[model samples]
Target: MEAIATQDRITSKAERLRILEQTLIGAGDKGVRPSEIARRLGVRRQTVYRDLRALSNAHVPLWNPGRGRWAVLQDQYVGTVRLTIHEAVALFFAARLLVRMADEFNPHAVSALEKLSLRFPEPVRTQARQAARQMEGSPRNREFVQALESLTLGWIERRKVRVLYRSAEGRAAHPYVLHPYFLEPIAPGLAAYVLGYEETYFRSIVTLKIERMTGARLLDERFEEPANFDPAAVLQNAWGIMGSPDPVTVRLRFTPDVTRRVKESHWHPSQHIEDTPDGGCILTLRVGHTLELVPWIRSWGRSCEVLEPAPLREQLGAEYRAAAALYHAG
Candidate 1:
């Protein structure tokens, strides 16, 4: 990539004098247009006129207008500037993402940026700072950030590390690392989840809860993997990031009063909806795994009915009865 032209590094007057002399000496190049120079160089029209006049003063035959056309008398281009608005925005975001992700690893650079004012123009600097501030606490998730940072580094280094993690059912274990592919932002905004292969399961990209991670490193040696390890394909179809091979086809019914509530939100991608004859709605959700969705399913109370997946229906019924038994035992 060619360097972007900026006033950041301006040439000496002596170098400018040499270029002007060369323009005067060269016959092919003539008449640097003020407007073209200003547009291409990213500066005011007056700045271009000033440079042209500076050249002309030194015996260079540079002209602003001649025969309704203007061209640069100089054969050499100092540089070029061609940053569109879209590119500028993208660069701004990329920088902020880097700063947020790399703050602890390179604290010196981050501190330097914060202490001294940005070298860019005031408006651009202000906008960038505002964008950074917007990301600072938008998630309100500072509790797991440090742990995430360490895990992220371990993933990049391809080393085994131990983590005291609480499972979905709240079981604790020291999960050893096999390999880390990537992290993903699961929710539209705020939340992030680390999806990586675990040594315990050998190549399964287990979905671990970032919030439940206890960043305690273990004394165990680094783990290894063979060349022929294959990751489970069932993860792609898993609902809510729970990868389970034994999936179920689930169906739900919404009463007339709660029909609008059921249709308003998208629970899953493959959800099917049908309008009922009694002005109600039938919501069918096919979950590849129904383990984590138990609480969510039961929250609907009498409004939702489990119409398929005999096992899930049985599980929910047992759970409901067990809860009722809590009061009976009391």
Candidate 2:
């Protein structure tokens, strides 16, 4: 009971300090009064004065300029970085998107923002708080979240992990020995992929969907992450997630209807678009394989045509034939 009471005292002291810092840091030139701090913290005004005196004695850079105003002096605030309301809001949203990926509300992140919001003045403070409450996060699988957390620990500690993963076809689960290196969050934060060294795949790196990872445990063994390991450099060779290190040159022709959309944002790092004589444009890319690119190619229907890379063209033809068979059969 004594230990519990002592812990409570420590927690209360920390909260008081946080409140004091937040109030002073955001107080600007007008400064804050003991009454305001006391009222906000539900403490007596004498307690606020005593706390301020203690803080000043501890070299906390608090100043009691003339009058009853207490302010955080500018000279003592030089070293630390301060975030503006806009930056704080942006960070809040970005963190919100990742919260779903973690499969739980991140209390630490929320608390940090809450403390930072204390530094925001007037309408901006209210706005930041409201935005934080209203922002929506993506849906994440609990099992996948657990796996990701464990794998992240292994990645940070440079330890190996055993993952029970199920393939897309819903096959039986298989245990994979992995040396986790990096996590890649897909654009718009829809999903994430984990890239690492799989013991079964020699001399090459492998990728796994975080959602497919049912279980992950850190092993006692440790491994060194390659100094030159870069996810972008490795992914640059392909259209989507996983691809070979070697880049392949691929070209395609797109009709005028969707030419602008195709040219607006780069589909691949190596993409180059050229206007054709007809009302169309030719797109070129140096990628690793056409397997992932096949589905996207088919999405364009007749608007897109594979030009270079004869194998991709043949594969597209086969896809078209199979698709046609499906429609004809029905």
Candidate 3:
């Protein structure tokens, strides 16, 4: 009986260590407190501390961020990849772009940059590390991170997720069960959105901003993406991330002063340019909606004119008049 009890203790210790490691990894940058770890493992705080020490001695990159919280340095645990000099430089550039795009602190991005920097040489390595540090300085939005994680899990596993979402209009957050199909990053990359099927209320595919999700939880049930659903095709007519079922033809004339500037870049795949006799140009394209195009057209100021879509032209005219009124007021 004594030998059997000893064997049981050994088995329990082994199992506890395995569970402990998983908990630390899942904790990410937030880490877990020793007390929380103890509670989870049904052990004493001292025992938890001892286990953490044992794991550290075994070469796990465990990090402690005050208040007795412990976490795993995930970048250190992942496998290594060898990259050529040109590839490393390209990766470094991509990492910098990500840093510039993010508006909030994202630990995973920081970790990725740190890991990539380790493989780079000299000045490039230093630059990558600097970019990671800059990203670390951004404000931490814990709720946003949690929502993103839940949605990511659902999307990868084809599981349904319940999220409390609020729209840009500042409406009250409402719950919905969603079948996440794709995650898309808006151009210039300041924000990310998920396009999914709303199973509970809308019963339609909707695009939701990740930052607007107040809460999210993965459901037990799974789903399969629609056979005919193609994200790229769906968004092909989109001016930005939002797409419309019915596309409209848009025509814009750029003054000669800015026609050369516009012709320098291919704005859209559906665009066709026609040079006018007056040295100006008319660009035509079919887009889902003109809502997103409004801002871009406004950016060109007087150099641009909306020739087709009378409603859009009138809308911009009213906006311009309102702005003029503000400036012209005594």
Candidate 4:
């Protein structure tokens, strides 16, 4: 019982500190009264005052007017980095996953996100929290991550590194000079992924999962990339970050029941939405043949219709038919 009470006290203290920081940070140099803090945090005014006192004792750079209001100390407020709604949400979740991927990725990113709780408007913060929950994060591969960091660092420094890699086809293990062009984070575990080409294999951008790197060895070979090497444009036509030279314009129609809900959120940057007279909504996306969009499209079940893109529609139609055949067979 005593230990439980102590734990509760610690939890309460942390909660109060969070309330205190959020109250002051969002105040924007304006002072906040205890009543306001209590109202926002759903606590008593006295509790708010107590939390304020605790914050002051912690040297949080807060000052009380002595009349029962606390304001952040002048010249002590470090302005937070301003972020748009999508940017904050994306950054928060991405940073969180990155930190979890490589243990040494960035310890301070979580702290920064914690600070951003106060930085964002309440609605944006809430929405971002919800958005963060929607991501599909893979398990952290720590051993794979460490090897990636070592090799990527060596590669960027113009040092050649031999990497033992397993291809996606699971055919054979090969050693080649890995040039890490970009880091892609698939899930919560890997900090970021390294993309480069292999000297022993195809010169195309081979994606090396940061968490799957088995071994890395640094070599003494240095060569500068082409002057017009534009990393951003490298995968211009790629679908869902996996760029390919060929892209298709895929069109989909959502059933009346699902159209409104679908319209409430932005599915893709290249999305175009049109409402049908009867009620259904048409969504078209210009993307590569990368299969990333399949899961989202499949989630709607019979409610979604693939319209303009014959290939996508055929693919989905085949899958649905196959599933139906299985049911009938069973």
Candidate 5:
């Protein structure tokens, strides 16, 4: 009976410690008082203090913020990760790429990079630490952070989210109740987008940029993801994050000068390249929407020409002509 009782006490203590850790983590930088922690966990102040000490001894990075408040140094706490030298080198390079890609501050990214750097040796470690510091210096976007958090919660818990979104067109903010299906990071890494089923407004699956979300709230209403809904399948033909139900085939003729540059990388899964008679190349690919391809097509300048889908060709022609007129007027 004594042994059983001892086991019970051990189990209870372990559970309490787990909950206590979560409570402290959720408290964030402001932290919680010992008295508040005791109240929340239905424990004595002495017990909370004892657990805090145990956690601190276990290297949980708990810190006192005066007024008897306790908080975890969130950024300093990274659970153990074991990596081989090759794996670590790969991660180091990926970290650098992420740092370059990030246009806005993300505390989580900074913390992750800092943690990863600790596992490395010498110069590589120093470089990784510097990369993290650089990211830390970037300006924080509170709205984007909040929206990302809310959408992340919705996606993880299969909950609906209420969002106020403003489009790129600078239109009035519109409200949406979305069932977040996926969170996707778009190219150049400057923006993130949430693909979801809009219960309000669109009444269909739509992609909304996270930066454009002014406000977001996680709803109590939960949802079951459709059995047939496959994110990869949905984005199979996507040029970027936005994909259409119907796809279109696009072909572009690249001049010899840029043909080698274009052929250096695989741009799309559906791409088919053929050498032209004039030492140029004809690149053909299927994409869900021409809209996402416009900027990419324009970036190649006079080195490329859109040969198929007359509508897109005409659109680019009109835009080019308008730009020419502006330059001519100037």
Candidate 6:
């Protein structure tokens, strides 16, 4: 197939740079001719020669190996960035994380890394790439990625969106109209959620999981972000992603078995720990209603107990009874 018209392909300065880098790196020892570079760039051969000369003058390691052919020396690039080992390792892992979470790994990130590695100091690049591979995980399905991209566009354009979503309860998918405002990243996924106004429920701000959105489309209508909307303030006391509008002060007592572990980690922004007699500890948190905390408390089993909030305690009792009944039935 004929290559895309170079003018159509190189739409931006960044694209031109990427193409030049790719061509130079691909032409290892054989060295590419100026005419070939001109054909690829949709420019005249003279223009290519001028650019090459300018690059050489700028101390870019471009050299003519032989026979009117030009090539970039291996591991030598113009304006190559030098990153500390720690910085390189961090970026490598971050790229791997984005790749793992994206349906198709971001092409720009992959391309940038490839370009950087071409000039990175020998063994460090190899080591960082290896470590990154070990950090990679499976990406989401294609449809989920598409939905996420659509939602992101809506958020950026200040447009409303309609979404077909499947809940964690395994119920049939339902449609929702939302005014997407922000995207927040949660655990188990590298992608963030679309936090927005649920139009069906007026004045309610809800968090929508992008992965659960089976379908999404942006509406023509635009929205004004709420003047009082402050994401940080809204989520200041949240235990997890979703929290109650009216938070409660919760007190829980943990037995000595897990106090050390519990104290070592900062569970929430409002969490406070007080040492109790008999080597136990009391954990206090001013947080949203206790719906999301149930699983966390239950995970501790008999070692933990909710000391306050009668309603939450009652809910837990009911859940335990339901569990007992299910086990007894078998």
> What is the Cα-based TM-score of model 3?
0.73
Q: What lDDT tens digits, residue by residue, belong to model 2 across residues 1-330?
A: 999999999899767976787688788767898988999999999889888887676556887765788988754453233677677666656655544344434343455556556766666577556644543242435677677777877887788888888888977988888899987776422456888898854445788887788767879999888899987778877666766867778899999999988988878878888998777899998888877778788889999999879988988888889989999997
The per-residue C-alpha lDDT of model 4 at residue 154 equals 66
The parts of candidate 5 lying over 4 Å away from their true place are 1-79
- Per-residue lDDT, model 1, residue 323, is 85
**lDDT, candidate 2, residue 41?**
92
For model 1, the stretches where C-alpha displacement exceeds 4 angstroms are 1-143, 154-162, 166-172, 185-192, 200-203, 216-235, 318-330
* Number of backbone clashes in candidate 4: 8
Q: For every model shown, what is its TM-score relative to the native structure?
A: 0.49, 0.62, 0.73, 0.57, 0.75, 0.62
For model 5, residues 118-185, the per-residue Cα lDDT tens digits are 89987889999999999988888998888898988899889999989988896799999999999998
| Colliding residue pairs in candidate 4 | 101-189, 101-190, 138-187, 140-189, 183-193, 184-193, 238-243, 238-244
- Model 1: number of clashes? 3
Candidate 3 C-alpha lDDT tens digits along 1-330? 999999999999978988998899988988999999899888999999999998888677899866779999885674235799999998988887888888988888898899789899999999899999999999999988888888888988899999898888967999999999999877543898999999888999999899888778989999989999999998999878878779999999999999999999999888999999999999998999888899899999999999989999999899999999999995
Candidate achieving higher TM-score, 1 or 3: 3
lDDT (0 to 1) per candidate = 0.59, 0.75, 0.89, 0.66, 0.89, 0.74
Which residue pairs show backbone clashes in model 5? none
Clashes of each: 3, 0, 0, 8, 0, 0
State which candidate, 2 or 3, has the greater lDDT. Answer: 3
Point out the worst 10-residue segment of candidate 4 by lDDT: 130-139
**What global local distance difference test value does model 5 have?**
0.89
Q: Where is the poorest 10-residue window by lDDT in model 2?
A: 131-140
- What order do candidates take by lDDT, descending? 3, 5, 2, 6, 4, 1
How well is each residue in 46-70 modelled by candidate 6, as lDDT tens digits? Answer: 7677677666665668777899988
Residues forming the 10-long window of minimal summed lDDT in candidate 6: 131-140
User: 1 or 6, which is superior by TM-score?
Assistant: 6
